[model samples]
Target: MDALHPHGMPKSAAETEARRLIADWAQQPDQQPVRHFPTAYRDTTPLPAYGTTPPVPQPDHRIVPAWAAGIAVASIGVGAGVTGIGCGAWLVLQGLASVTLTSVLLVTAPFAGLAMVTTAVAGAVGRIRAAVTTHVYEGPVTHHTEITNTSHQQGWFTRTRNDIS
Candidate 1:
């Protein structure tokens, strides 16, 4: 069935009905194209020129004055210095604000106590282990001794001797 005609009209009937509707629409006065007629009078006045010719192009060489350049450099340096000082001050303030005694103690007290307890326990355990443990030497003992004597004589003459006992 064609979706455009729910009554299940034949294709030929649908085409004929569409053609009749188009013809009826074309015959209506509002749908007809309007005719444009040319005017009998003509305008003879010339239009006024409001634009002027553009100026001729010229090559430009821009040069900055020495004093002006110096001023620009000075200003940039001053600005950078001010910014650096401001940032330093801000960092110092932030550091001071964040490092309160209460906060420092609160954050570190538990760890400090834990470390002390751990150190005490470790020390006690180490002492007890050391007291209960004993090590004995199991190798032969040997002794070595060396004696040396050096004398500088006249005219860059030198004598040296080593004795091992």
Candidate 2:
């Protein structure tokens, strides 16, 4: 049925007329509402083949819990720091065989310095990469559009047209 014509979403008066017709249809002994929906295949087009059973519906849970993931990442960083501190302490206290404090610290000094330098280099490189770098060229350009976008309405498109056509 045409849900809308000149009118909007249907009025109660129109619905009463439809229900009257439906009641007349239901009163016919042989007719059933089953014929309203197709149940078998046909030549011109395949019928919808209505099933007795209905499909189960599922709930949507698509978004990630940002608070939970943030907590997880923070805990991982904390664990890594704790591990580094514990490892450094163990090396200093339980030195190999009979190594003196000076020799032990001396031996670990290079490794420690290298580790710290590597960590600092990694963090510096990461921050430098994240700092927003862009390149601009000074030259003539045919198109110039600077539009800001938001979610309230459909967007606009523009292009240059030649004077001839």
Which candidate wins on lDDT?
1
- What 10-residue stretch in candidate 2 is worst by lDDT? 156-165
lDDT over C-alpha atoms for residue 133 of model 1: 85
RMSD of each: 22.2, 34.0
Q: Give the distance in Å from residue 36's predicted Cα in candidate 2 to where it truly belongs.
A: 26
Which lDDT tens digits does candidate 2 get at residues 1-165? 545534674566578878999898878968645547657743565446785544446899887799989999999999999999999988866766567789879889999999999999999999998887768889886764555444433358555433321
Separate clash counts for every candidate: 0, 0
Task: Candidate 2: list runs displaced more than 4 Å.
Answer: 1-60, 96-165
Candidate 1 overall lDDT versus native? 0.84
User: What are the runs in model 1 whose C-alpha is more than 4 Å off?
Assistant: 1-50, 101-165
TM-score of model 2 (CA atoms): 0.24
Q: What TM-score number comes out for model 1? A: 0.30
Task: Score residue 53 of candidate 2 by CA lDDT.
Answer: 47
